[model samples]
Target: MTDLKRLGLHDLHLSLGGKMVPFAGYEMPVQYAAGVMKEHLHTRAAAGLFDVSHMGQVILRPKGDMASLCAAFEAMMPVDVAGLAQGRQRYGLFTNETGGILDDLMFANRGDHLFVVVNAACKEADVAHMQAHLSAVAEVQPVTDRALLALQGPLAEAALSGLVPQVAVMRFMDVAVVDTVFGALWISRSGYTGEDGFEISVPDGGALGLAQALLARDGVMPIGLGARDSLRLEAGLCLYGHDIDTGTSPVEAGLNWAIQKVRRTGGARAGSFPGDARILAELADGPERQRVALRPDGRAPMREGTAIFAPDGTPVGSVTSGGFGPSVEAPIAMGYVATAYATPGTPLEAEVRGKRLPLTVSTLPFHPTTYKR
Candidate 1:
């Protein structure tokens, strides 16, 4: 096996009792001493810290203004990037010619340039694709000098408010570059756990110190990937390789909102991206299969790859992501089911360990997100 890459906080995580595990080619923390269950609940009731430096970060600088930069990105993404306002962030996907998602990303318009964050597993390929396609339109610079940390949960704002007072005023999806006594912190009011929180981008040298300072605050504790996955599942968020991939289109993945209406077939920037015809068709008519939330009856925990069946025992789909949600306190899952059977409360069965477990099509999220919108 190849060696796992270490993030800047490798040593710090060891010191803080993080149970290191291989993830996305990195030696990441799967759970700390708090364990996945407590870690998951802690984030819901209070706050938890996460080291996400393994994810890719980059800055897109255009030869012209932000409009040109947006146009540069819009060439590959279906999002109406050119229309993004300053300090606002949008979730977008890198789509292939067949309309399948290459990777999902978060990009913020910083007034002068675009700041992007991509899933760690696909970042290498994502960056290479952007460089090959966007070179002529903009400058793509990878940000290796920084470490990313997510402070997630209900009291996250209160914990970090002491260091950065302005953060308390920021609303969901807002981005800002704030200066602290420690140094410059590039922050975004966002997180994956269906909670109000911040993703802080700190210089590599200050990563450990900043994390320590944050953990020092009341209700703040270090969390890990195990809880992160369970949390996102409860939020009905897609995990790049599991819930979405090169074989799934954005519309089929239930991510239509990511594409602004202005970029649709009749809109201002229509037909400007890969798989435009097919994607627009699916958007108009709806895809045959749609990703939806599934709540398994009882406590069997319908895991991924489990076959989903109709009342008559015909296979209609398979679970893409599944697990027990600590916050929801039940077995929750998300998968692509035939559109006819995708409505909420639709009865279905999930084949788990050779037994047919009852399930229902439920509206996401299993738990409502408490973003400060």
Candidate 2:
């Protein structure tokens, strides 16, 4: 644990009775004194502050023109980078030559440059990938002097707006750099908890102060990674390395919505990025298996690696992400199954502890998302 990196709020988490554990090379808090169940419920009802600083923060500065930079970036992935408007953010994926996902990320078109956020474990490789590919048109700059914090829930807007009144006007996916006493806050109206919230990047020096101020609010509580995982799972969002990875394609992972039509086979700018052949083919002709939402019959949670079986005892797929959804009050899961069984209400069985347990394919998002659109 000594070799693991620590966030700026490490001491603050310890003070709040957070149970520290290793995650993505960081010694992060998995749960606080309130436990994962209470923390999960509290965030759905109120606001939960999360320390997500371990995730990578990066900037892509254009050398010539924004259009050229976007073009250069588009060469790496099958996304419509040029179509993104300023002051807005969108979900993105880094794909390998074989059309498999290297990582999933969020990028914001910040007028002059792009602000990108990648998962903690893939930061180094992601930065290197960008530099290796976009060096001619953009400067890949890694931001290391900031801490990222997420304030998420129904009350997030009320709590955050109390300190920074300007943030109240921001809608979902809106990104802005607001000046505050704590310093310039690069804020995005988005989060992974399927709630209305903001992801704020504050200077390292002001990280603790801003966290303390937010925690001082009436409904804000300190949340840890345990609750974070459950919250995202309930939302039906994919976690990198688990639900999505280098072996999975965006089309197969049920992320076709993220790829705008412009990049499709018949669209204006079609078939130029890496793995375009395979990705576009998958788009035209459906994939063999697709990611789907799963609901276990009883209270027992079917964890990851649980294999799926057909009605006649034929092997199908396996669970990628699964857990007891605190909000849904039932064990929920997400996995890839034969496209034939991906429909809603399709009966199936999960091999949990070597016994076939009944389950069903359900629509995504075990719980409804309350984003402020």
Candidate 3:
């Protein structure tokens, strides 16, 4: 087998006794000596720091026409890119020609440039796609030397307030460039753990120091990939290769809020993205399948790829992401089922280990979000 790639924090992780596992081609900690259950609870009650440096960070410089560049990006994405205010970030999706999602991403306008964060596994292909389509109008630079860290949980504010007070004042989805003891960094009021937190992009060499600083706080703990997945799932956030992919559309994936009505109606710039036809069609006439949250009865956890069947034993869909939610104190899952079976309160059965577990289709965000704003 090929050796797994390591991130800048590999040594730090190993020293901390992180349980390393292969994730998106990188050897990362799926949990630590504290265990997944403890790590999961720690993030909920305190703060958890995650090393997300493996994700791609790119900068887009619009040379001649910034408006045109923004429009070009909007054409490839479902978000209202042109309407984004400076220092604000928006979640978006790259749709295929058939209206399926290529990937979900986060975009932020940093003063004179545009910054984007993409899934680690899809970064290369995403960059290639952007370069091939945007080279004529913009300069796309991949900033691989940068490291990203997520400080999440209720205590996150207290942990970061001393270093960057401005971060405490910012609302969710807001981004700011701040100078800290570590150095100048980009701090965004964002995170995947469904808690109030910040995602900081720092210089490669300084990442470890910043992580150490956060870990020194009273409630701060170094979290691993296992807890990160469970936290995001409890928050109803989509996982790239699972909850969303090239086969799902932004609308079908329960991400319609990301698409502004103005963009859908072709108000200012019109439909310029790849799957405009299908996307607009879905906008008018709903999608064939829709992503929904599932609550499984009993203690057994339903995992990804578990077949979901109608009450009569007919296969309708399958689980995309699932596990025990530490916060909710129950098993939670997400998946796409036929539109007819997507409504909240619908009853379904998940086949696990040859036994049919009763489940109910429910609204997403199993736990209440604690974003600053």
Best by TM-score: 2
**Model 3 lDDT at residue 154:** 89
TM-score quality measure for candidate 3 = 0.97
- lDDT of candidate 1 vs native? 0.92
Best by lDDT: 2
Encode model 3's per-residue lDDT on 1-373: one tens digit a residue. Answer: 1688888988999888898999998988999889888998999999999999889899999877778788888888877998999999999898889888888889998878789999999999999989987888899999988789999998998998866777778889999998776777888999999998999999887888988888888799989999999999999999999999888888888788988887887566657788888888887899888999999978889999999999998888999999999889999999989999999999999999999999999998998889977
lDDT (10s digit) by residue, model 2, range 1-373: 9999998899999999999999999999999999999999999999999999999999999999999999988888889999999999999999999999988999999999999999999999999999999999999999999999999999999999999998999999999999898899999999999999999999999899999999999899999999999999999999999999998899999999998999998889987988998999999999989999999987779999999998899899999999999999989999999998899999999988878899999998899999999
The parts of candidate 2 lying over 4 Å away from their true place are none
Q: What's the TM-score of every candidate structure?
A: 0.98, 0.99, 0.97
Q: lDDT (CA) for every model shown? A: 0.92, 0.95, 0.89
Q: How many Å off is the CA of 84 in candidate 1?
A: 0.8
User: Which of candidates 1 and 2 is the stronger one according to TM-score?
Assistant: 2
Worst 10 residues of 3 by lDDT: 262-271
User: Looking at model 2, which ten-residue stretch has the lowest summed lDDT?
Assistant: 265-274
Better of 1 and 3 by TM-score: 1
Error of 1 at 192 (Å): 0.8
